[model samples]
Target: MKIIWTFTLMMIPGVVSSMSVTGYSGGGVNITCEYDKKYKENTKYFCKGDWLSCIDRIRTDIKDKWFDDGRFSLYDDTRSAVFTVTIRNLTEEDSGTYHCGVDIPTGIDSSTEVKLKISTGQQTRTVRGYSGGNIIINYKYELIHTNHVIDVCKTSSDQCFTVINTNRSTEWKRDRRFSAHDDTSAGLLRLFIRDLNENDSGEYKIIVKVSEDYSFFSEFDLDIKTDDCCVKSISLSASAGGSVNINCKYPQSHSGDVKFVCWRSGADLCAKETPVNESRRWRDEGKIQLYDDREQQLLTGSISHVTEENSEYWCGVQTDQGHKIFITRVLVSVTDTVGPAAGWPVWMGITVACVTFIIIIIIIIVLYKIQKKRINCRSAIDEYENYPRTDPRTDPRTDPRTDPRTDPRTDPRTDPRTDPRTDPRTDPRTDPRTDPSEDTYTSLDLNTRSSDLYDTLTTVHPRPAVHQ
Candidate 1:
């Protein structure tokens, strides 16, 4: 149907509050608005845009009956004192401001604005399950539309065929293969499909009815695969001294076979090496253990205290006596103590703390020695300054020749050069140059006097005070 979505109404006032609603392109959305009980019998309408230039799309005067227009519908539940407006086949242009209003006989209508946002991209999800297994898918709806019909369908090129629906019962089952359960309180629809085969792999969708012509949908892709003897390869890592589990899948036909694990080394491809076979209970061989879950069709091999020796292994099945078929190659690596599941080991922390403590001790010892050396140097300098030293040139008491009090020659009273009375230049009577007549008398005395008397003559007269 060609739906015209725009129509103008008279400008109104008194828009109190607003709400937000979200929908996807090509999907539908429902908006539930609450009103006072006094307006239970009043006409309720839904419109687009703001109050000044609002365009009314659909209005209903009858209570509890849905009134439909092109792409829009309105229903007023008088008992609940609320009105619901549903918009179908939403497009990008339909996303804008809308209003849920009740008409009055007086001043203006009572309305609450709604902001609708339509996403251009459709949300799709993917799920995978093994053949002969079961899968469960869940979808949620708005609380107001929880009681509406919910259906699960498988899609073809252009159409979808309903597999199960909640129209007949809230819990519906079909052909023992498809089932649906609608949880009203949680607003969840859960669909279950069991005994999955390769043919069950396809695109499926969930449809939630909002109105007679409007419905919301979400699509998902389901991939189902047939079981092999085991997976091709698996890579796992575990911290050293930790443990790991290697799970291998097999077909139901080999569920009765002897499941085992062996080391794959050099050129032996697990043939020459002994296999750790499964027993009735968990059987341990060295560090590895094997367990067969017949009901789950799985062979689980567990290695404790993983090391480099546990690096390469294989998942095998012994169909004939003394013959094994290695199917999956498992490559394991031993990591450090720091890993996602396994945190740092206790020994590592202790080692780091010990090294840090030793370093701190060494630093303290070095600092103490430096401080001691500085103190010793300061002490030596202080001792040198306080020590007594003797100098003959400065201290007269330290040397006898320079001491004037101890040496008679250095005394001013005994020294003739320093005493004016003992100097002949000061006495003219003893000096012969003062009296020339005394020169001949002095020569006669010098000629007649002995060597001892010459000292007395030289001492008595300074002899004109010779410069020598």
Candidate 2:
């Protein structure tokens, strides 16, 4: 089952190579190598500048001169720098040291050494079958080395090498219920058995010898089981409106001595024993009822018109040794029997309507308040339109006319002293200091005729009204 392998790589001026060696049972072995670069021109079976070309030349020379057997060969190509040497069809006698070397014209040379080993392969076999049938065996042989091969045979005529392992060992068994077959080409070992019995359970050994010093051995165990004396438990099935069957099976060996009893618990306990078919204990509030007592150990309980309230009942078995119970506490809800309440939907609808009505009322109140404020503002503006503003500067109460001298235009009749047209107010002579009122008229003085005319008018006064 285990293999050891070794790989190595080396590089020197103008040359690079890698090698791998594997060891297996039966002295089988393999050696492989790869070169670094392709060969160039000026290479007569060996290129001076190319590393792989030099390696190819060395590989060809070694195959032809050292190991020229049919199992050894060399592979090389111009497109790939890689050069490989293979040794196939390995055997115990083929294990030895292998070397690959390369030489360049520029005084550079590289070489690698590999040691090949071989071992006897381990022998193993596999057998498969049902517990109650005959056992079958298969054998196979595997070689550990590349150039090696293994062969297995049996010592007795009754049984031959039914199976072999990787070590090339022979597997043999003396059991009459089992048989084995071998395929040498495919390295497959097959086993066959008919009417397998329970007693055929044990380990079988395989022995193999390669030459005189090399040998391989292996062992395998077989087990068989019978299907008898099995115990089966009870299972119960029930539905909403239909009855159920509760069944239990006792061991066939104890069918006669075993007694069966049925019982129910929860709210009340009721038990019925076998043989007598009499109820030993009973409590009733319609709590627990024994529906059917067939065979005593198994019972079929019916809950007529099963309802949610009666779903918490328990059913089980009771015997002289002990008691077993099963409680059904799952509340069975029936969709047809229970539905939405009659007034629930109606009440919900009314509630939603009321909520909507309240919202509308609130909106109306808000809008009314807004409109009322607008009307009040309009009325205030209308009332303010009737009033007119008065200027304080032109009002009579604060007028300068209250002071007669301060008035720029005064009534001419009211101020006789200041009148310039009055003759009595003026002085005719050119006297500078005649009168204060006539001082302003001094410049308008007229001749004595003008003064005489004024005196005549004064003297010619009209007659007063006689009859008044």
Candidate 3:
């Protein structure tokens, strides 16, 4: 059994300072040391060991020296009075005590000491998460105050672009990959890393800048996993003339596999395929970049100058035998660069649509109310038109006059005795001659006939005495 023990160098005296750096056996780091202004023009050298018999591996002269020895590079800045040394592709034998010293004319020269520890980290803690999932790493060390500074980095390398400082709000927020929360009460700092991929798997260091008095360091290892298929379908939206980068994941076992993208028609594959090496392949109009990362087993692609005319394409990989195996279908929607309302942005168009919908509903409601009001305003005369079966004769106002019985056009007068000539309604019982229906002609003729007959009868009675 092999046991590895690490010790902190804070126990050393003589203006004491120490920093512990942890890294993987195949990984690298950069060491930075600060000095007083008096050491500005002094020659800076990096050595491996205690002050006495330390091995002089590399040195720097006073005149802005830059030293490069393959895996190691050293730079001494005379103005800042600081020197930095970078080591790459390290191994277990490379781990040891290192010191940054300056050649001084006076007494014992000044130097800063640090310890480098290398391990495969098989004995340390680890975590696994999906490609698109998030991971929370907890550091339980107590903090001095809210002012405690913390930085999370992929490696111990100095000035690495992957270094994210928690003290600066914008630095962590700007990078979509990282976020942090400090729980002052529990003395716990939780780091949230998102949009993870296989490349994110590695050793990570946590640095705490407490004060000029001392500094603290902690390390964690991550082992990110993926689903069985590794890659899933992706849908992307962009504006006309914009660009989009598509990333797909594969297992490390599938290294050197041929990646492909082609147009698709329904369930059938289109004959035309895009060539990755060519600058323009997507419908002969898109500029594309294809990169295969053997270490991370990730294939990323970028399409530039995409318009709405660019459409459905399949992203896939070829097997060792060169058979195409599609993993995901890519749907790219390039929207109109200019919105419905001229010069308006996407949000403004959405707002206008909502407002338009509301206005339509209000207009419909107003029209319904207007129709109801017209129905309520109808007069009784108009309502009567609905009943066509009713008889006008049954109505007493057939003449539509107030008094039908004594109406001047119908009866002329109410009383006939007033003036017979003016009163067209004079009664027949009042004057016999005016009774045309019964005795108008017969009444005058009967009287004359009877008188004539009686005179004739008297004369005929005397002449007829003998016949009697």
Candidate 4:
């Protein structure tokens, strides 16, 4: 039974027409399916997989109008007898066999099988040019696609809108800056772009259609660099009452040329006073001083006492009589405060350094005073411990008149040594040796009472034999 089924399947027609399409991931594709004019009003459907038992993706009921569903869109051009299907934002998973079918109620329907292959590779290249220059780009394709529609476009946001294409005549001159030449025998498409500038730097696409609706493209990134003629948009700043020095560099070949600093009114017009002769020493010319250092290939100009009126100036080298090629543009700004061109003004940096130095000095002074006080207190304590006070007249405890044992007014009942509140060992205020706070004050008190303490300890008196 399986062998018979296989034989029967082989005998059936797979598809009435077939074609292959190529697309890139993250891109889109358009597929045009041509059908007979007799089925113009019939319902059409686009499906996936085999045409006989295909899964329907989109079905159109209207004629000559587009029907959109998700990423799939279908349009039936009844007059041309062809319908177009568009798939957007394609991925590798979208690569499969699809069938464009026309539904018929009577008998078999008409179907066209489409094989889509999605590739994941970059087809881009880099082409570089200079400012104020021209460039030519040549794209090669298979000779079979030479007769197909070719386009050159600027790619932006995944769209390749045409700039120049073969849909027009071979001698098309709609845009003078852009031109195209189709070399059919060599299978080359040559594109010429004249007088390139910075704004022209971007990605360009060359697309060649392989089928009625499907085409592929290659990308080129154009990079335009600055020319040696001049440096553009240079900003320099100076104070309102000060002078500004303008320094511009030129090529070594122009070392012998006369350099100048003049006011530029137009592209090639220098309006202000003519610059002085080139000299190694500064030569005065009106309010400006000019110096041309040929050995260093440098042009130096200085404007003294610049005001707001001295804003725009050009530093250039004279190539011939009454013609100068500007090497650099100078935009001078006059302001009270310093500008960004000179970062962190000198006065501000000096003030910060002085404040930091003063803080460091104050820290050192505080630490030195604390260390000296500690050393002095230590020496006073050691000296006060070893110094003696053994004299009877000076030492109040050795005098009989002041003795508590003999004097009735100072008896043991009132003696400070006997009463706990007044005893030297218990009373914190009376006994300086027992209290740590009192000991701290004693070191400090020595600074003011050192002489009185020394006088009491040094005074002498004779000892009594029997005082009590």
Query: Which candidate tops TM-score?
Result: 4
Task: Write the residue-wise lDDT of candidate 1 on 10-105 in tens digits.
Answer: 223657556666676766676888888998988899888778688988987978777778888777889989887877677889989988888888
Instruction: Mark the regions of model 1 whose C-alpha exceeds 4 Å error after superposition.
Output: 1-12, 123-191, 195-468
Give the Cα-based TM-score of candidate 2 against the true structure.
Answer: 0.20
The sequence of per-residue lDDT tens digits that candidate 2 reaches over residues 1-468 is 112222223323432432334444422222333343533221222211234343232234332123333545444433444344444335565455555544445654444444555444432332322343222244445633222223333324323354333333243322344334344456554544445554545555544333232233344455444433322233333344432323332222222232233232331222322322233322222312233323443333223334333333333233232222222122333333332322123335468779999999999999999999999999999889976666657766566675455653565454557554344545433222444324333444555337654455435532223475
Query: Which has the greatest lDDT?
Result: 1
All models, RMSD in angstroms: 25.9, 35.4, 19.7, 29.1
Task: Please say which candidate is ahead in TM-score: 1 or 2.
Answer: 1
How big is the positional error of residue 452 in model 3, measured in Å on the Cα after superposition?
99
Off by over 4 Å in 2: 1-20, 25-30, 38-68, 103-106, 122-468
Write one digit per residue (lDDT tens) for candidate 4, span 274-357.
464565877776667777788887777677666676677766565432334444668888888643323333335468789999
Query: Model 4: how far is 376 from its true place, Å?
Result: 74
> In candidate 3, what are the lDDT values of residues 292-331, reduced to their tens digit?
6656766676665566656566565554323344455677
Local distance difference test, each candidate: 0.69, 0.39, 0.60, 0.69
What range of 10 consecutive residues in model 2 has the weakest lDDT sum? 40-49
* Cα lDDT for residue 203, candidate 2: 51
Which lDDT value does model 1 have at 213? 28
TM per candidate comes to: 0.32, 0.20, 0.33, 0.36
Which is the winner by lDDT between candidate 3 and candidate 4? 4
Which candidate, 2 or 3, has the higher TM-score?
3
Error of 4 at 407 (Å): 99
Candidate 4 achieves a global lDDT of: 0.69
